[model samples]
Target: MIGFVEQLLRFASHIPTFHLNVQLLVDFAATCEAQLDRWGILEDVDIAIHYISEIVTNTSNGDHDKLQLALSSLYRERAIYFGALDDLKSATEHGPKPQALNDTKHTSWPSKAIHAGRTYLAHGILLKDTVKAQGYLNKATDLFEKVIAIGSGNIALLVYVCESLAWMCELGHDAGAEPRLRRHLGSYLLTDILDQQNNPRVSTGKHIGRIGFCYLCLFKKGSNQKDLENSIKYYNIVMNSKAIDKRHPCRCALLIGLGHAYLYKKQDKWAAHCFKTATLLEFAIPALRMDACFSWAKVPNIDLVEVYSNALKIAPQLAGLEYALSHRVDNAKLLKNLVQEATKAAIAGNDISLALMWAEQGRGIIVAQMLQLRIMFTHPGIPIIQHKEPELADSLRRATTSLHQLDALMGTMDVKSTRKLHRDGVRWNHLVRKIRASEKAQLGDFLCLSIEKILQLGRKRIIVIINAHGDGWDALMIRKGDNRPQHISLPTSNERFSSLRKDLFNAGLRERRSGDGASGTTGSDNTSKVKGRAVKKIGAQPPPPPTPDSILKIILVQLWNEVVHPILQELGISVSTILP
Candidate 1:
């Protein structure tokens, strides 16, 4: 059957009728990729892809929308393989960009603009060029809107519409139409289950999750309560879904999103509950758990110290061990809040050990807090996996090496790369299943440094930490042989501290005066991962324009009166002890 299909491709160009014949060729190529070792030769995918390109090159306009959409999907399907290959390099270090489907034609069935739009969006995501990505997004936005205006019955199209909108918002662009359809997604989706006779598609949790995200984006920009409600509704749908298991990693993020939404609604109890739940889900990835734990601390009137402490205890994975020092720094920066909040919780509870641990972590002095710990161990290193499954690791390494070498020479619709990508993808999938079956390492106590390690690093030095998180500033004094760090509640407000930090950065004070103990004195710890991280703060406000001298004088006076002088007076260190 495969051999006969190959015979047709050789003389396909001569055939006057194109659509059905060409689809057979494309379908065959897809089959070969799906089951390469079954019947078809490896070169068949290459030939099919090549032939499709020639046919599409001539079928540029008018009526080939269906064909174009099919080609686009094929392009996207192959792109996923590239993304996977790129991701495999993440076992220990970040990998370089993988090969993309660069040869996909701009063809989409004219009637199915949404399909074409989707293809463009997929291709755009693979491209590094900002302008091109935006262009593709814009085209997708237009196509989605046109179909939506006609009120198409293909409910699946509705999900992509919301996805495109959310993606556009992420890119700092908006078509001003997200709320139109997604806001009332309940009206469209009567039942959470995808009845095969109806849409016949599953993964409703994720589909609705996208709709929820669209609403989330809308609420962020406009502060519309309705949008917030819609987002919360959709997120809740996913959370309560029967088809989506509780252990699904995607639910972990949904829970966090739910936590944030509830927080915004002034429903502190629900918000805290959601965050606590997300933090405790052991099956979830460690990075997300860390984020959930961090969010859990921000909810006022909630004593999540136990939860936070538990999250810190589970460092079984290698999230923070990224490619470079800068990567580590970024990772640490991500969880700078985890450090700040941990310190605050410690100070409130008078837990000296937690205070010292967070103090060091927030200073970004010790290795980056698992900040860049986004699940995938990035950076393409040559070391084989050192786990018990050496043979499996060796297989993974070989697959990665093969993909890495071939990625450099491949182009769009390149069959060779596609076949290799498929093979590796299968290997990776199998490896994942095998590892899951073989993996037995459980969560353990990890984040806290031993007393000996801290003492060695400090060398009897007094570690003074000024933490400015939540409502006010806190100063912790870590001395040798003390059961706990002495916590001092400072007079400086959290808002004042953030503004001051911002001002110092603007005026180059932070850069010029490095290693000052005041670096951790930030309401945010300067994170940009979550939008409105500052605005969400109880008394947060924009920083006043650069007033270097005034800011310096205020900070110095506060330090002297509230921090320095008090410490000196208590320790009996007078002017004589400070003589240099």
Candidate 2:
């Protein structure tokens, strides 16, 4: 029965309804355990469970994909076991009689257990069930505590286990266990990243910041002073590493994590100092900087506006013509919070035009990726290049496809994945530069619209860009003579535009929409973004708050009077008809 349930779980995870099915499986397993207890063989179940585990281990052999699946196997299996045990404890009307002394131990379980525990840890952190989340987290802590002790200090075993744990920590679980295993995991990771003369391998610093997170998680759980110190210690060390001291993608996460550790340790001044240093790092992603700013604002007497203003000032960088549509989407979502803060700051400073530019950058990520950029080789606009340089076009088409497919992944990268991503990023940039350099390509500007270019677009006619901010609306108008954008606070709010960034991205326009007032401002929210919320069935819930035709129209009419009418009036343009 245990083996059958485990196999069922392995298959179930690949399906959409796995969570819905888990409770039923847990109940069924409990019933089977109750029957086993009646036969005085309930305690032998652990042996059967581990026996199947050995078969799985032997089957996985040396395949990496198989290894992760094995980890996922243990993860789901233990969750089932724990659920069944809970069923027994519930004293349900009819439930399993689980054996009291249930030990989940076996040789070579350390690495497998840690891997599975990490997946469970990610799922737990993301789960909305606070009670259930905490329950599984405790189970994981106990599981890690038990298995980490069994393995002797083989450096390979220690390094693999430590790498898994550090990345798991970076996945941001609200879990910290007793200090011993965490320190062991973090210490091994730090061993590789710290400044050392004898170590032949140069650290890319990709996974090094994760070590700080491992120790931070430890400090959270046990309140161990040394764990917090070690977290800070490695954070500083990793930051100062020759690789990280300069601009590096890894620095994005490191500064944020370090800020948190300092916050926890009451080193408020050092934490604030991180914000200044982060601001100096030209390449650090804006979204990450926003997070650091929020954390720094926790210090008493600090100006809140000043902190978020820093987030606002960090401009969104172009994704370059080579970036995947999905990558551009990811980058935009990351920049959203900072854009929001920046917009608010603009409102405070009465710099309406500046806020609009920031909002333009934040919304319509795909729009930004394609518009103002020359067409791809397939597009008719680039026919001359495609026909003349057919071979180059083919190379570009293939390389561009490979680059997009490579960077679209949405999970943690081990060292191998990190190297792969870096290579693809490099290769794609090289190809783009090569294409641009070719005289025959005639691409002109294969890039997103520059702020100056966008302003120039408004020289001939009026262009009003409206963006939804929280529950309100703000607008920027560009007229011919006054090259600078003019701001208008629209009279009404429409929630549909709140997700304008996402909707415009999903639209992914085939042709850039032009000759419009507030172009790309009113992205259609025809699709829904439930975002893990339960989807309602037909007639399942009351009618939604009056949407598109009603609230949206009202907002539009409000814009006509408050924004367009005034601009046109100022321009001496006549309106033939008047509206109430």
Candidate 3:
């Protein structure tokens, strides 16, 4: 009977299309019914009936798209069924259930609520219907409250419910939801999960990092110094521990969170160090790097705008007025122009949704501009003085001030507080610090620099010489007035050399031949007897002495070897030098 059920599931799993296979589902239901009858297990019969009913309801409509959705719904149902079945089988065969499961009280209300809420949320998103989505989210919230009322103290279940509520609140900021989210989170104390002597989860630093994250989030909400301290403490524990797992998401999040917290406290140096550590953690685990956009917005750019705008309210910069007017052509000015264009587009469209989307995109562009300014100001290696292009700097400062003012005015609707602004500021500072400390140190710096320089100096200009050989024979040349280096060819008896010479000439390099019919003179005939005798005694033929052409080649080769090679090496170009 077990083998028959496994075969049925295996067949169901292999359906090529997501559309519900009604015939296959019916077969499965029949098989389950037969098995239930044979075993006469009342619980199994009840479960099978529930599954069949849900599956039938889902597939009743039978449009291909609806069928596909139904199939997806069934997938989750099957997962829950499999889990339940495994539990039942284990109870029958083994001595007892795991202690954690044994301790967890079964609450059907919460389980039913979670399942229905998930279905509604999925349908809301799939249909892109905001009203329906909110309805489902409300249902989910109600279910979560019922679970809390049951008072089972199931940490996993509570965490999952709280996270879901937090996500729903974030989807569209519902002011009423904040208190509830906080109340749910407050239930878990430090001692609830942590072991007495050491953190049981931190067998290898990953769990310690996760524990730190939980603390960091708590610190953000409650302003608890102990939570922040414990976060950093656990971070240090992970960093110092030799058993660090490179793939751990917890480690990456903890490092990033630590960096943001330190930045919030105005400890710029410490914040930068934390950010640098976070960046390294991201490299070790690339999935974490996507959080950069969110992290960068927290500190120097967004918060700086808030701080400067508040300051500007009392003390308007007369100097900034003159500067902004003079540099009306810069990026800040350009961004303002784009925003105006976007606003015009919105007004013309006459659709509120389109207008809101355009306005949001425009805001993003403005934020990007702010990020660029913050990057210029705070990046460690780029000496701040170098950014002293008076007009451009003035424009950036004005723009920053202007954006802050805009944010404040907008704050009547979306008012961000000083604390939130400060938190964001610290986060940005940390990110800058982490980027600087990356393993590919110079590579990171170069990448951050203006795109033009990256395209120009960093790109390699290869000069391959055909048939050139010897310790000093020059195979490549870059003329004083030329934009790129040129290749040169030396005389050779082989057909490969003949083809190579043609290739070099085609590639814009000078080609000259030696011997009677060639353009250049033969130097073998000019070898001195004394030098030839010395070469002969050493059992080696003397190399042909330099002619005017050869001397030019030698000088050009020497110039490249001494000058270009070092520059290329410093730029991290891993190309081999062409030798003659």
Which candidate tops TM-score?
A: 2
Cα RMSD for candidate 1?
A: 15.1
Q: Candidate 3 has what TM-score?
A: 0.32
Candidate 3 colliding pairs: 263-426, 275-434, 276-434, 298-424, 298-425, 299-424, 299-425, 470-580
Q: Is candidate 2 or candidate 3 better by lDDT?
A: 2
lDDT of 2: 0.52
lDDT of 3 at 142: 64
Ranking by lDDT: 1, 2, 3
Evaluation by TM-score, superior candidate among 1 and 2: 2
The parts of candidate 2 lying over 4 Å away from their true place are 1-107, 125-132, 151-231, 243-249, 263-338, 372-449, 493-559, 566-578
The candidate, 1 or 3, that scores higher on TM-score is 1
TM-score of each prediction: 0.49, 0.51, 0.32
Write one digit per residue (lDDT tens) for candidate 2, span 274-344: 76567545444434555566676676666655675555444333343333334445656756655666676
**CA lDDT of 308 in candidate 1?**
57
lDDT of 1 by residue, 1-580 (tens): 5668767665566776634455565567567554322211223444554556567655644324334444444445444333222222221021111121221232322234654566656745555247676777777666666665755535567677666767666566555655554553545463344222222122556676777777787787778899899888778767766644554555677788889888889999898888878866544555667778778878887775676565554332212321223433455455566557667777778777677675765575333323322221442221223355568656655655655566456566365466555455344433433444344422122223444455565546776777877777777675654444566677667676577767867777554544343334345543332332332344566885555787777777766776677666655567333211
Model 1 misplacement above 4 A: 1-139, 146-154, 164-179, 182-202, 212-237, 240-243, 260-270, 281-300, 304-319, 323-334, 364-443, 450-475, 478-484, 488-569, 572-580
Once all C-alphas are superposed, what RMSD does model 2 give against the true structure? 17.0
| Cα distance off (Å), candidate 1, residue 570 | 3.2
